[model samples]
Target: MFFTLPLSAATISAIGGSTWSNTPPALGPSWDGNPPGTAVDILSGQVDEYLLSGGVPGMFSFSAGTYNVTLLTEVAGYAGSNQLGWAPLSNLATFNPIFDGPDSPIMKQTIAPLEGWAFVINTGGGDVFSSSSIDRFLAMRSAGSTNGWSVGVEDLRSPTDYDFNDQIISVEAVPEPTTSLLMGTALIGLALLRKRYTKR
Candidate 1:
């Protein structure tokens, strides 16, 4: 089936009831909303691309703000001509906030880094965007890849809208693969040296 990993303590800060687009890593979009900042419509695969709420672009400033993070999905372009599930949308993965609360509705679950993150986008029950509908969670390797994980609608409401995009998610991680590679190389070298010494 599709690639998947177990859940971890990793979480991506997300907001409910927001539209997001794939934006490259760099200073975030315009921030003229209210409060500390306004909702951003784009995010990039590069974690460093995002900045503090009002950081300057093209500079080494960490902009900070609660901006929207967007991820691409495989369902963006399906062969079907229906707005149903697997249909192609200009945008890959965009969520309309399935779960919202009085204090905060943004979803922040324990999605580990370097794992696939898929949403079970089904419209049923009293609400469509409720986390309860998020039936399936896949093991996505990285946030750079498309966010499409296939799952069934076991306990869904009536009038099934096959729009799997209903469950929106992205892969995120802190870059550290280089270190892992180096450590692996050292271990291999040590093993070879030990073998040679034993032969002598």
Candidate 2:
């Protein structure tokens, strides 16, 4: 399971500006109330649907694999001080920053099966917003046109525009051989355990 998120690779310092221009139009509205919608489900089809159940609306499940994350666009007033990180879905409080600023280069991160992680944006004033919540982040599939996923963020504590475009990112899955091997090894181990138990 892999994702390729490509944004503008540019930072916009202006607040409330049309920074969302880079966001794919197919993603639809910024604040649609329901997030991690049907599109998110499609993008993550590699994982069993059962794993995607029981999380907050914006939270998602990914199979154990290496994901290539890129900080495409950080268009916000707090773009410089804000940070993006991932935390377990069970615990949104545990945030590990992937990048300190918008200018950071592409990063590669590995996720474990059932680890259940979500993205979090920590503001300059220490305010934290999770993608698990609809108030902070809105996610949508790119209408199958880009074969990608996009997320729009509302950074302000008291948003004036409710644009939810403060931060924009696009994601697409990329295949990796190591991840397949890891999955195969786990399956083999499970099969061996089952055979040994059956003989008892």
Judging by lDDT against the true structure, name the best candidate.
2
Q: What is the C-alpha RMSD of each candidate to the true structure, in Å?
A: 16.0, 13.0
Measured with C-alpha atoms, the lDDT of residue 194 in candidate 1 is 100
lDDT of every model, 2 decimals: 0.27, 0.47
- Return the clash pairs for model 2, or none: 4-172, 5-170
Report the lDDT tens digits of candidate 1 across residue range 47-116: 3122112221111101111222333322212112112121012222443332222112133332221222
- Candidate 2 structure quality by residue, lDDT tens digits, 1-200: 23333322211111211122223223323343344323332234432221111222233433333344555455456667777776765777787676676454344443332354566777765545443344455545523322234555566675433555556555444444454566777888899899999999
Q: Weakest 10 consecutive residues, lDDT, candidate 2?
A: 9-18
Superposed Cα deviation of residue 132, candidate 2 (Å): 3.6
- In candidate 1 the C-alpha lDDT for residue 125 amounts to 25
TM-score of each: 0.21, 0.51
Q: Name the 10 consecutive residues with the lowest summed lDDT in model 1.
A: 56-65
